[model samples]
Target: MSNLHARDYQPDRQGTLDGIRVLDLSRLFAGNVLTQLLGDFGAEVIKIEPPEGDTLRGWKTEGIETHWKIYARNKKSLCLSLRDPRAIEIIRKLVPSAQILVESFRPGVLEKMGLSPDALLALNPSLVVVRISGWGQDGPYAQRPGFGTVIEGVSGFAAINGFADREPVLPPMYLADGVAGLYGASAAMIALREAEMKGRGQVIDLSLLDPLFAILGPQAANYRLTGKVKPRTGSRSTNSAPRNVYRCSDGHYVSLSGSIQKMTERLFRAIGRAELIDDPRFRTNSDRLRHAEELDAIIGAFIGERTQQENVAFFEEAEVTIGPIYDTPQIMADPHVIAREVIADYPDPEMGHIPMHHVVPRFAQTPGSIRTPAPALGQHNRELLAEIGISPAAYDELKLAGVICGG
Candidate 1:
């Protein structure tokens, strides 16, 4: 059992990003996820929001916007008006010490606010700036408003994700934004290192339109070479056979992927169909794909005759690849998730005893932790301003002037 003390961890272990600082001027999932990645690895992130607050603050379920809480953890929230000159001056003051600055304003929004990359980099020569956008910082479509759903459709992602006959489905989650955030986090670190080596700052122009399209793996190459678009084969792998979800006797779904020859042979033998292995129509992968529907029907019949647990037992004993489809409840109750501590207790003052997935890509020597809960709006404003030499009297005056607002 892990305890909440430094002594509990190995003596040599330390947070890898302990000394780095980030100023987040971004909104929504893409920018939030990117900064959260850095925060999870021990960067001190100060999230600067407008006086009104982030738009996601109102995205609620039963009157709670858990999205804000989940993505804003391990960071400080500072509320200030960008339109105010005093607030702009305060941001300028904070820039010199920040190692990273991330923003997701549209192409020209930052420039209009007088906080462009060129100006920010000039203020702190060693800083790394990550500018997240929809179509990107420049290009014909740069200024067009784009959401994750819209981008998924426009990026050629949603078009090929469903059954060929069905209306295409957007991903269940914010897939494009999340993928872009992951890429942005990776790019930020790389740019930071490059800046250190070159003794200057660098700007990362990240677009949500790019990463998801880049990760559609091999489809682009296949199309370029063959001039053929891949048809959607619902719940089946386009490149392999016997890789689809099957309904068991109890009505629970079990997905199987007996794609490789070894697993295919094992599956056939386990199902008492050893004779079919030598049959010309089912002898090779290419041949099986040619008759995938027929093969899938046979496998489905076998699976349908057995309960999910029984099928699981048989697949485990036979070394055939399979897994029961799980909803959120099963995932929370799963043995493996518990054993690995994948979900951790995220203690919050307002929303107590919340469960959140813990930090990932854990390191042996420098693993990170969720040191703080998500901050209340402008929770760190007083402390942050005080650190920058603002006296209490001056702070109260600024708050009264509508230049800064924080509780």
Candidate 2:
């Protein structure tokens, strides 16, 4: 029923990361995101899930595992009851053939399971182990559970978010997890490259707190310089002026940024208030920042007289930077989004076609492709075990002993 572009799975398509093998032992969002990135680029991502499956599989929409379906695409699932020593041995056996290993367990959990970074390195000397936690492995908070929500609150992202008078607003989505996952992917590739070239492996201590805090962009330096914490000013930049979301006549909102001098002047002219360009309160960037409230009132009044589309068109014609604040439906319906196939309907067994984002950072020569849909629990257990020379009898014995499960 949707008008979004449709795409088919290219299972045979090769990607830039072809031949790389990843053992994903992470449970939820952050690990899934990291492995998904590698999987998208044609890495053999073996999701080593517990018998209960990855926590993401339980995140359902209308009883459909939509989150898993999206993030777990191009990945193979192997279910095992990690409580058993045989299961740990199976993991150890698989490590020699795996280039990378990702785990999101709390600090010391892997070591408790007798699969410490040292032990893993002993088994596979060139294996790049990515240890993801809420905090660093040896930190004071390492023993505490490292959920993304807790990390987001601790990372100072919530502090500078939302309105000044209101309480700090934690991001509704998985901000800490998402940022950590992106960082982990890059770090994994770097470690993998080093292992390949130098024939040595290392452990990456990737914490949700570190990556999220690193992206706050010199907040510490700014605080030290000003002797103050930046107050939350919703939608308004602390550094730039004439930058805020204004409501249009039709009740739709549009974000306009006149951060630069020329753009502000052009915006004033487009609003038929060219004289305000030289107004003492609105002349320079600092002056405009000081009087942002009054400037916003003037701009808001002009914008409120027009619909979102009208304001966008007028500002575009005037060569000022402005765009509509789109909701999901609006984004899906936008001409440019459709043209670019930003969201495409891919074949889904239950939904017939489910819309998800395209592979990001597109390449010209060796572009990534969605090779397959999310696999069922333990779907690749037989095939994957075979790769490590586990025969059918041994696999059946392990399954009987409850070491392997699902599929």
Candidate 3:
């Protein structure tokens, strides 16, 4: 690798996770995202992978696995075969120094490898073991392998998404997995806090299905009250009026959200229809709901008359909530995106500029930064092994015997 990729950003400012160490025994998307979240905040994350590297590293964009480049930033890599006992021994040695361990293997894999929660805690009494699985660690569906798409379908996300006319949509994104990773990261923090206070650590049994379901925002409550599954309404929200995507004159689309009375008034005023605010059919939220289609048509027509940029400017001036349905390039070029510093580019010789999203939820005092680039397989083998007290000779022996993948 080049010097720029090898170099990591060391912020002069303090970070919230500066003293933390994490052992990431996960691959693909969800678990990897979780560790990256921690690492973004200055956690020393060591990713343990099998010899061949993470399965998702093969996934490509423009002939590059861009996902790995962004999500695995600020973390080190250690390639080791979990099938080997010495690998487990190496992990046990790491456990004592690590504050958190994240894993996404199927329910019984850890137990099979003799690295169950009990065994891990025995090695490090205060370790926060975060376990994320498809249906959780103990349920009937726990043993079966599943990914974000499968979980979305089973967890009712797909059921509530997309148009009623078409087959339920599996989101283009990894919806469930991303939600699960956030939930898992938050759970790990809570567990770490409690462990520090109580002088003991515990296992976090987080399910891929549950977190996505939990974030449905009153969908379950609505179901319980009505005893009916909410019908899908495409891009429109079932709970609100005049909430949908509308095409502009320029053939671009923009999303509008005039859900509340205040926002609806602003929208109406901007569209030169202030008189509609006092009309009986659009006075209140309930009244507007009854005439949602009519209101949507009015708004959509107004939007259709204008170019996307014109509508964007009008919404900005009117202070109504609106946004362009931007593609990747559009978003990257957006003014607000640039102003917020949403994307940061790093030095990459081949790619020229490696653009990735910056760390989120800005902190006034302890903000996170994009420090390191993604690691090559086993890039941190020697340095990480040294921290765990493995000698140079032992490392050579392990590599020679195929006990470790990278040394």
Worst 10 residues of 2 by lDDT: 358-367
RMSD of 1: 3.0
Can you write out model 2's per-residue Cα lDDT over 1-407, one digit (the tens) per residue? Answer: 59999899999998988999999999899999999999999999999999999999999999999999999999999999999999999899999989999999988899999999999999999999999999889868888988989988899999999999899999999999999999999999999989989999999999999999999999999999999998999999999999999999999999999988999999899888999988999999999999999999999999999999999999899999999999999999999999988889999999999999888878888788999999999999999999888999999999999999997
In model 1, the clashing pairs are none
Candidate 3 local lDDT, 1-407, one digit each (tens) = 22212223564534688889999998788898889899889898899989988876788888887888888888889999888898999998899998999988988899999999999999988999999888899867878887888999988888888888988989998888899889888999999998889869999998889999898878878879999998888888777777899999999999999878799898888889999999999998888878877888899988999999999889989899998899988877777787777876676655766777778879887788777788888999999899878899998989998878854
Candidate topping TM-score? 2
Residue 287 in candidate 2 has what lDDT? Answer: 96
Extract clashing residue pairs from model 2: none
Alpha carbon lDDT at 204, candidate 2: 98
Clashes of each: 0, 0, 0
lDDT of 1 by residue, 37-115 (tens): 8988888899999887877677777777688877887789999989998899999999998999999988898898888
State the lDDT at 67 in candidate 1.
Answer: 81
